[model samples]
Target: MNLQAVLAINAIGIGIIVFVLSLLRRQRLHIGYGALWIGASVLGMLVVSAPPVFRLVTRVIPTSLPFQAVVVMALSFIFIVLIYFSVQLSALLRRVTDIAQHIGISELEAKSQAPERNPVEVEKRGE
Candidate 1:
């Protein structure tokens, strides 16, 4: 299949699906991710679709291997970065959950031992 054809088809399908999901859902983060996916897909297509760009890179690098190796390397870097960020995000969420649980426990303890108000004192204060 032609690269241009694939790019156009995917761009439309992916963009429409993401737009629909964004409209139907309230999750800004998910929407942002979908947008990022769409952007990256389009960018990837643009970069990889042309033969001249590949030729230019091959000339500049003077590599026996094709430019696809470079593309793979770039993808590996992206995957590594994604994994690192995901781990960091998971750790941050765990800390937040711990803090929330601690706060809930503290609040419950405070409420359980709270002193009761006296009716007599209330009446005297009202008088």
Candidate 2:
């Protein structure tokens, strides 16, 4: 790649890193996810700016076209993020289920322990 192209990629990568840090600072993003973005940006920068690493990646992910490596890399990153989100969602679902069960049990127990009123007297008052 040309120097200009490399510089542009580096600038974009740096911009992404800065944006992710800003999100982290604002509490809009979790540290774990922010780290992922930063890592991706760094990897992208390295792949573009470093020929050796780029060659290695291309060799490992061989494609019919030269630019396919970038496409494959983007797809792989998306797949990883999807898997991470699915795992997080699964864990959260389990936690929510457990919490709901506990709440239901607590409510049941409280109701059982509370004093009971006579249905007949309650109806008479209503009348």
State each candidate's clash count.
Answer: 0, 0
Task: For residues 1-127, write the lDDT of model 2, one tens digit per residue.
Answer: 5788779879998999999999999999999999999999999999978898888888989997645886799799989999989999999999999999999989978888755568799798995
Local distance difference test, candidate 1: 0.65
Model 1 over residues 1-127: C-alpha lDDT tens digits?
A: 2566546745764675677567647665555656655566555555556667655655665555665544564476579769977997999999999999999989978897655568799788995
Q: What is the C-alpha RMSD of each candidate to the true structure, in Å?
A: 8.3, 3.9
Worst 10 residues of 1 by lDDT: 65-74
Give candidate 1 regions above 4 Å deviation. Answer: 1-29, 56-67, 70-74, 112-127
Where model 2 places Cα greater than 4 Å from the true spot, the runs are 113-127
Candidate 1 global TM-score? 0.48
For each candidate, what is the lDDT?
0.65, 0.88
